[model samples]
Target chain A: MHLSEPYLSRRALLSSVTGGTLLLTLGACISGGQEPSPTGPDPIEPVLAASVYLADRYTAAMAAVPDLADRLTPLRDAHQAHITALTRELGTVDDGILPSGRPPAVAPAGSESTPAATASSGNAAAPEVTASPVPLPAERPAILADLQGLERSGRQQAAALCLAGSRYRAALLGSIAAARASHAEVLT
Target chain B: MTTGDEQLAEALRAEHAAIFGYGAIGAKLDKATAQFALQAEEEHRERRDALLLRLSQRGGTPPAADPVYTLPVAVTDQASALQLAVTIEERVAARWRSVLPQAAGEDRTMALDALIGSAVLATQARRHAGISPATVPFPGAPA
Candidate 1:
């Protein structure tokens, strides 16, 4: 039950970590996660943001197409895992759920009917993939095409980021990108 | 060889094994799946050839393919064949995933292509084998 002196806030911890990493990466500015300096954006932010955006897309899709639940929910859960990994790397806290503002239109009926997406998850204890029972009846083809497009763009973005990232980061980004590419193939 | 070159060699080895594995898989499959296996084999051949050239251009004697490989599962019937197919794709995907961190430019691009390709193929094979949630969160990452 021991802790840092003066109960230093989480921001202080994050700042020191970012500052140390920035020294090697930037070699100039000695800023950290707290102080907004001229380092543009945290490189992790873009991929992290992309994962959040992709999760939202999944939420919308699941809400709009209930029958595709069995299909789409697992992909969405993968994004959740991606978000967890990225956030963990950034030294940020995440409960490992969908990131959003407004509440979901339809809440999950239950996790009982859902399946785990562990075939890809590195975390053995990763959460179960869940879905809602929304009554919307969209055309399956159109919905699928839209999802395929989302996955293609997401994959490309992550792939580009992977190329520019550090060795460790590259592996993480590459895996996430590969998942999206597979998603596109599945949708096709 | 540098790390990237080593990774390339490892991935190439996987490609070679996959080409051989698919042959075993195809023999037990029906016409539809046999055609599918042939296409996958062809793709692996192209990759293996490309990697062989890359290693040679780096001024080293590229390693020759193994005379044979011991498959993890027996391929005596359709069910086992499909299982072997999934197993091959999974192993190939794992090899490609290892290459991403070391690879650059053309190597990186090809690694990504192979990783994604194996992942997609794995899903299809899983579906054919009747595995649910055929898709994965991170295709090439360790389970």
Candidate 2:
């Protein structure tokens, strides 16, 4: 995949030529006040869950296949950083769906599996999401490709959110989208 | 607050420099890699040209590209050429990332698109350079 063409950039470029004006027109219609038009179930929470989901998936893949541990850890840590940065914007994560997905300021790298309640939202317990929303494949190469797929999908989702989110959050969303896009390249 | 046009002009400036940097970079690379380098340079040129039109349409004066830009590294060989490529893409990405927070509509779309393009190219350049990890946690973020 070293010489592979960028999967999303091509589509993004084409859409940007046409979508930019249309997106603003649509935004103008619904944007009665300062809040951006809703694109997902929630503003930033879904992005939060998605990052937690990715971080947990990374932890699972690392534990399930030890050979990839060295390569996967940093990618996992990136998701953790995404969580902290996003939660900072959302204030406190009392959304109920994710609980204390927000770490107590900074959770150590290894704390992804703390599996204990933290004071913020008791949602740190969700870290032990050993059983993910998407099940893992037991095979070796399959799991790597599987994780790569997750990164790619997550990248697309984040990119969409980044486009629709507020200008205040655009930078963070764009960074997360870019990070996930890069993570897929590293998976192999 | 930085205006979107200001950021766009800055990114256009970065794109101008990237096109200039790629010329030196391509000279040091092999035929196959140089072809890749040419494509990268072409993309920057396209972006620079587009941003030029965009800024004019918005009634802003686009900055002129310098006749020559100071190379970040002396590209004596392929390794240094690749290093310069990475450096250019990172600078380009940082410029577009700055646009994201300030621009909206088509401008923001262009910013996001260009930012991702720069990030992807940077990863490819890093991989070609044999840099480990080959990807960044945040593409435009300062090291």
Best by DockQ: 2
Tell me the docking grade of candidate 1.
medium
Tens-place lDDT per residue, model 2, A44-140, is 5545555655676677788898888778888888888887777666654453222334452256544532212221223222223222234577997
- Backbone collision tally, model 1: 0
Report how far off residue A116 is in candidate 2 (Å).
Answer: 9.8
Worst 10 residues of 1 chain B by lDDT: B124-133
Please provide, for model 2 over B1-143, each residue's C-alpha lDDT reduced to its tens digit, 9 standing for 90 to 100: 14778888889889989998998998799887887798899899999999999889877789998999999899999999999999999989998988898988888889888888888888888878888777877889777
- Interface RMSD, in order shown: 1.3, 1.1
Residue pairs with backbone overlap in model 1: none
The lDDT leader among the candidates is 2
The regions of model 2 sitting more than 4 angstroms off are A1-42, A93-133
The worst-scoring run of ten residues by lDDT in candidate 1 chain A lies at A1-10
Q: Provide the lDDT at B118 for model 2.
A: 85
